[model samples]
Target: MPLTARNPNESENEQDASQSGDEKPVLIEIDHVAIAVNDLGEAIDSYRESFGAVVDHREVVDSDGVEEALLKVAESYVQLMAPTRDDSPVAKYLAKKGEGLHHIGYRVADCDEALERLKSLGHKVIDEHPRPGSRGTTVAFVHPKAIHGTLIELVQE
Candidate 1:
């Protein structure tokens, strides 16, 4: 499915007509909401105690230098991440923003296609190509400046 360039002046019906019947939607769903924390274990424990949430998956991504705990929430996840190294992006985020929401992961049919579509629309992207993400997913990061200050991760599982 191809991503349609949206025209602000077009009506809802006109926009709908632009999409072909056999084409898949560009965005599938909200994959997860990532939170950067000071301690992964502490954050996991807190979620378990407060909301009865259990960690569904945990992994230390050496490439990103961060450990993450995924708590299943419906078809989505509440991802809690902590840095494994001082120079990691998560570590820098923690040093600057303390503990809070980091980025949002959006499930897409194809990371490459989504990236191309975003680029064609003149949106700024952090990753020029998709890379391996946690849980064997293909992902790419879109710059926050292009999405109203909210960092977006396009995830293809």
Candidate 2:
């Protein structure tokens, strides 16, 4: 049975029918799960010992003041992130929240569209526009307060 995807911005027949219930997932896939830690090396070592996961990509996103190690797990990644500077957001997050799961990256077909959808639904957005993310993906962040205290990243892979 096909379920109607009602969009107030569109006409009744124009409403998208792509999503017809739980039969189809709204997001493409789980892009990565980011964990903010005090020490990237220590976290990487711990994952290596416990799960034998190895770093597939390592990048220091100077713009975000974070050094990240991407450990591949199937099609997704376990992103181990550490702060590079005192004023970095990650540093602030760690200071306030301590080392733990930061934000979840959910793969999307179109980041701009996803962002618009969230905004249309009256959700608070951290990034108003899609920006460059690690690994050449375009991304936007949906504010945690809007998503029940879970930071959501819309990733266009």
Candidate 3:
């Protein structure tokens, strides 16, 4: 039975793995995990000193209200995200959650296409359209409401 019809009492549906029947191959890969912190410079220095990893990219995503420093790890990245504005989500996260892992990002060939596919499969999304992201990429956010309790991001470089 399809997931949507499996349990009427369930508040959510699973990922559309069934779409592979005719869809193209999986073109996305886990890109990075973002951690929201109160201090960007301190986090960067700590990671470098403890893990021997250097910041590969750093940028402020004004739209998302975050300043990020990315440390490369094999094919993925460890993103240190800090709020650029007092009212940004990261600021709120730090205030309420007190600095911790925020979201997981999946690298895609086409962010717009991936977001469209996600929406078609009934996933709740934060970004109805793709937007500029840190590290010179395009990105979109998938709402946690649809993906268990994890917030997901689709990134295209």
**Predicted candidate 1, C-alpha RMSD:** 3.6
Which candidate order results from sorting by TM-score in descending order? 1, 2, 3
TM-score of 3: 0.84
Kindly provide the TM-score of model 2 when superposed on the true structure, using C-alpha atoms. 0.85
Task: Flag regions of model 3 displaced more than 4 Å.
Answer: 4-19, 22-27
Candidate 2: segments with Cα more than 4 A from true spot: 1-25
lDDT of each: 0.92, 0.90, 0.87
Q: Give one digit per residue, the lDDT tens place, for model 3 in 25-128.
A: 44467899999989999999999999998999999888779999999999999999999999999999899989999999988888999899889998899999
lDDT of 3: 0.87
lDDT of 3 at 67: 95
Better of 2 and 3 by TM-score: 2
Clashing pairs in 1: none
Q: Kindly list the per-residue Cα lDDT of model 1 for residues 6-119, writing each as its tens digit.
A: 444555455443543435577789999999999999999999999999999999999999999999999999999999999999999999989999999999989999999899
Q: How far is candidate 2 from the true structure (C-alpha RMSD, Å)?
A: 5.9
What's the number of clashes in each of the models? 0, 0, 0
